[model samples]
Target: MSDSRGAAMSDGRTATKGLAFHRLSAPSVLALARGEGGGAAVEELLTAERSRRLLLVRALADSLGEGDPPHPAGTAPMAHRAAWTLLARTQQRAPRVFENILMSPQTGMWLSLALRRLRGATAYEDAPLWVVAGHLSALAAAVGARAGLDFSLTVPVRHGRVPLPTLGCAVFADAAEPWGTAQVDAREGRLRITAGRETVTAGPEWSRSAPGWHAVRRLELEPTGPGKVLLLDELDPYRTFPHPSPPRLLSADEARTWQELLTGAWEILRRDEPQSTEAMRVGLMSLAPTPARERYRPHSVTAGDAFGGVMASRPDDVAQLAATLVHEFQHTKLGGLIHLGPLSEPSAPPGAPEQLFYAPWRDDPRPLGGLLQGIYAFAGVARFWSVHRHAADAAYAPMAHFEFALWRAQVSSTVDLVHRHDRLTALGRRLLGTLRERCEEWMAEPVPPAELALAQEVAADHRARWRAHHLRPPAAAVQDAVEAWRRGDARPPAALAAPPELAPVADTRYLDTAAVLARYRLGAPAADPSDIEGVTAADLLLARGDLSGAREAFVTQLAGKETASDAWAGLGRALAGATEHRDASRLLRHHPERARAVQSALEHATGRGADPVELATWLGLGPGETDLD
Candidate 1:
């Protein structure tokens, strides 16, 4: 066991030696990243180069203050072997540089000279590069000593709210039960670490204490022997730390609803594997600990998983809670399959948001901005698909069919984009295609004859209810889009052709921003091909006192899709008292024809001898339409 002063001297020597190794590793990595020379580049070059530098640094640090040239005994032998393997691999890959620089002692001398030159300068040449090198050297020393890998593991420890990478000397030390520790003191604007048992206490950094939980910064870890300890350290002022705030405690009835939600979802998971499912449930219960825990907070689920794992946050309210759990749980499953490696790697591309794969059950209206809302819609589609696969037959009740259709249509449109689709490899693409085929089968296949009749009856009831419900303009747009599809006109399916005229300002200004409200027709819950919104040519025709022209516009709009319900309604009204009354009657009877307001307006206009002024009054037409002159 070395004393603190002796250890510091040895650490200094190790740092000097490691820096020499780093200099040699740096230029090659720089050259490679810059593409200075070789055309025979492999994709793994960066990783390989990094591994090589780390290995060589480990070697020099390990070799220092050692017995023999070859180094002796235990983990050192393993470290030597690993370094040798890396050297051999590097030589084989880039022999010219390996021979000229890495294999020669002269290269070390050259690097040392370069370091002396930099040391004399007023300004640092490359801060992060040097910092990473110094920190990594210290880190490797500590980690090597602790892990017995002869390599560093540097974890940033907080000091008075500032974190600094502390150099661990064990990364270079050769002894039984090697250990390393580094102290960081931000209040003094410096770091101090003492080896062995030495009491060094610093002041507090940050604190967060609630009723049942406490989070204190300045976590400290004292090395017992080899492994590291978990201790509080100083917290940062500039860095924002989000603490979980407690929610209102659930009442008995609310708790019961949560329980039912959890139970129902668990039944599905239990069907797959009961033991594992129960284990997860137990784990989740442990994380929350009590009913007042905030569920939506970050790391709440992760923290819970550490204990046992909870299936849902509290599990209150069967429909809402189960929907939420199923959505997130689907992510856990499909994310693994798609991520194809570690959970750290995202299932989708770099820019993709988490919500893209995990839609929430609480159906809050989207964030105010329509573009932001649109972005969420994109993610919602993927989330819905993941949740949909686990949904029960009866689960399709209460807008379930609509939800499924929304997800389906999004997948179709998104897969058509080359960038998004190209991210899918051939096999992934094939798998997605197969999934689509399966979905189509489910949607188109007739239920058994008994169920078929029952489904038709249900569909009829649903239609009547839907019609009886006040059709908000967006809802009418969705219905019109659906009817347009039935009539064989579906284009741009739920896409805005151009950014709307007042898109930027109006989108954010009004509570009921026309663009965002209209966006719902083209998004999740009503992603039908015909669900177009935003003012169109039909509005123009109806304004011009040209019912004949408006009817033509309605026919054109419905020719490809039933996107505009307002347009459809206008057309119906225009023809109601005309020579084309028969044609108008047929259109008025069409599914999702006109709103009650529009229908009333049509009756009034017909009774008033097709007067434009009277029709405009009934239709809630603006001053622009009435030609007030």
Candidate 2:
């Protein structure tokens, strides 16, 4: 935790040589692979991340070489050098306070972004140079305030707001400029900021009424016996991933709601998953709330460089909130581990054809790295639901059980595919093997028959939908099938049996309709399906276990001008449920893209539609079969 631990040598080598050669014990690695790292392991990760951030900060400074500035007054090089000098002085006087500012999640994010911008790896349109380098000045201001130091520095003001990295933001009401700099003078724990002719001042304690300063809110929760604090950060420009954004501060009511939801979620995790609770208490530092998206489907993300930070939309309930924490923390842990060593070979060469694979949780195909992350994340999710199901009430239990059943299978199958990949290194193979063992252990656990069936149906439906959305059959094969049907041939051409290749489509909407409907059914069995946004009547019938009704509904829809991929996948689900029309069901489920392509080609050629089931039956039958019946 000392400043020297992360100090860079003259040649830019990290002084902390142990970090370069760090290795986790076998037991610790196994626990992490199973999504159960204790506090000690997390502490190691946090320390490593802190060192990485320090290295990045040094690199950022180096990138701005010590050369004469084109605009010597108030340029990035000048500001960066001034900030560095102030930080070194502050570290000498108040080491702990300096460390706190250095380790702030916003500091890490800013370091990565500023370095990228300096190195020309990213573009920032019309952004003033001070906007990137001024972060160091903001960090210095925060440290000075905390350490009761006397200092004055000019920091960037973006969109009329001056944000002190970890402390809070100062708003300028009279300032109309889009980008400028504010001079902050701090002495004896008091802060005064002046921009142009306007000025604002605040005492040691922040206050909304203290002229124009907004305090960074912190949430304190006692989930277990000990208290834990997390910053409800909405004012940090670096809170978002990849780049800086304008602050989206929460309202009073919204902030209170977030506090309540986080409290309940922490309590649930404390009661059910104490090990995970410990890991989070040590490593999960801040939560940045994004605008809410689709209901019951909260989006969450963790950046590789921003360790201990999570950016998530509001959740539907406490259980979901807790699960989101678990899911994102898994990503946080894996990101740290990958930074320590190689997991897979350097990413596939650009335009590599075999790079992308099926990811059960996403709408589009994922590359190998994304697939690995998803596998680890959903494995944690499956583990969460596996235990949460036992604690859930009757109304919620089905959904919990279904989630566990579905993800266990998905993670296991994905692990099987990744294990055989040629790119995994020795350490990567070891980690994957440990993860596979945990998945195998979970796979043996029994679920209720009905919930298990629903889980299987949802999985199959997603795969079929993904296929229909992303894969395209060979054009020659499709044309041959169309021609044979036009000639009134008894069977499809043998060429139609060729496997499909990926020609991804752009329409990804409604791909998760089946899963969404399943969740709704499990939560409120009698809920009206027509009220749902993406759920169709046929989907409702299938969700309710009315196979015959769903089959007829889908058939009627297909008989018309409807060419939606969901209809084809829906018919496949209904037929699979009925256990009749096996040939047609198999074709629709496995080669949905092929079947749809041939059907579209035939319709385009003759200016007339054909029977959906009959077309599938014909294509699915062996080449030797002579009769459509």
> Largest lDDT belongs to which candidate?
2
* TM-score quality measure for candidate 2: 0.92
Best by TM-score: 2
Q: Which ten residues in a row have the lowest lDDT in candidate 1?
A: 1-10
- Model 1, runs deviating above 4 Å: 1-253, 268-320, 334-420, 425-431, 447-629
Candidate 1 lDDT over residue span 260-321, tens digit each = 44455445544533332432332121112134322111111221011111223453223334
Cα deviation in Å at residue 204, candidate 1?
A: 28
User: What lDDT score belongs to each candidate, Candidate 1 first?
Assistant: 0.30, 0.80
Cα miss at 385, model 2 (Å)? 1.0
Stretches of candidate 2 off by over 4 Å are 1-20, 66-77, 124-126, 207-209, 347-354, 526-534, 546-549, 552-562, 577-580, 623-629
Candidate 2 local lDDT, 466-572, one digit each (tens): 98888888899889889888898988889877778887776476678888888877875666656666678898898888988998998887777867777888887
Q: State the TM-score for model 1.
A: 0.29
